[model samples]
Target: MAQLAVFDLDGTLVDTPRAIIETFSAAFGSLGVEVPDAPEIRATIGLPLQRAFGDLLGVAPDDELATRGVRQYQIHYKELILPRAQELLFPGVAEGLAGLQDRGVTLAVATSKFHASADALLSAAGLRDRFALVVGADQVTHPKPHPESGQLVLDTLGIPAEHAVMVGDTTHDLKMANAAGLRSIAVTYGIHSAAELATAEPTWTVDTFDEVVARLDKALTTQDQGSAV
Candidate 1:
């Protein structure tokens, strides 16, 4: 069976903590609301923009202020953050992704970021073409912790859940993967703590992107063996 590997963009492949913090600050400033500090904002990294903004603003996702915050965030993110945020791929990401491609894994991104921003940043980093598909928050009706986004990637790749793995840095990713019935691997170098990720009970947890690649290889091999039986 063909193996599919799904990834989360912000906290998984790249470290955008500064960009996220500044963007939230700028958006909140523009909207005349109190902006959350970096650590508070970091805690919400893997969630959709509306949800993150809502949490920061102490409002519901559908609240008008939250909606306005999302709009302002996109504006500032594209105009100010995107251009200034450096090519910030986490260490070993390029090599790990290349290794996965070399090993014949079908790779894709399933992120809570807007598709346009995700594409722009990936292209700027020269990593856009590596993924066969890029599923974003705007592309799905529901975001992480829901199965829709991962399921969309699997459906697009035509890969079964058993043949897929979701690699990310938060509980949201693990929860989504679990809901989709796919194995999950959590990385520690992003926003969440190893303890927080452990609550989700992922198939594996690693400290580096290289370990993620290694685990994927082992997972596929295990699947092959199980199938052979």
Candidate 2:
């Protein structure tokens, strides 16, 4: 049985919705572009900044405006929002991670955020020690939905894709897991709806982190049984 768990950071284990919306609002405002509404910004949470800006403002990733937008967003997020914002973790996140760690399930984080930011957030939340590895979008040639990021995490962990499951809150995570030939599980209480997540056709869907533990237990059991057979 596989003993590895790969998780997405934002929208999966943590809720940064308000910070994200405000950051984008500030970024676009700085560039004199129309600020996208909360829902519009929310829809692009898991994507890279360049891509998100491209999708929302039609700014090419390499364009100077896009570069400025990303810089502005980061400035706002890091300086204004991050320090004062009360970090919000989804229910069961700490418990779920602890349970998995107790069971000897090696854990890692794969996020679209930069490595530094991901590290700071996890450390701030006291979850930095729980993961064996943390891979960010900047570390990979391609980001989520591209499979490279997830595969990089697997490679670093020395785990076979077949022996791992990816847990996240967006289609990007599911698509990346599927493309990497790994099982995927989606949680509905994050950025995307169950209906939106269903389009990615994850192996399982759950409403809570407690359900995540249960599902992993079932999968581990099934994997063990199959091995015995």
Full-model lDDT, candidate 1: 0.86
Prediction 1 TM-score vs. true: 0.92
What is the per-residue lDDT of model 2 for residues 1-229, given as tens digits with 9 covering 90 to 100?
Answer: 4488899988888888777888899889988989988889988899988888888887688788888888888887787545643357777888888988898888999999888878888887789999999998889988989999988988887888878888999999999999999888898988889999999989899988888887877665355322200
Lowest summed lDDT across 10 adjacent residues in model 1 is found at 220-229
Candidate 2, residue 148: the lDDT equals 97
Report every candidate's CA lDDT: 0.86, 0.84
Q: Compare the candidates by TM-score and give the number of the best one.
A: 1
User: TM-score of every model?
Assistant: 0.92, 0.91
**How far off is model 2, as Cα RMSD?**
3.1
* lDDT tens per residue, model 1, 102-213: 8889999999998988898888778888999999998999898899999999988899998998999999999999999998899998888999999998888899988888
Q: CA lDDT of 66 in candidate 1? A: 92
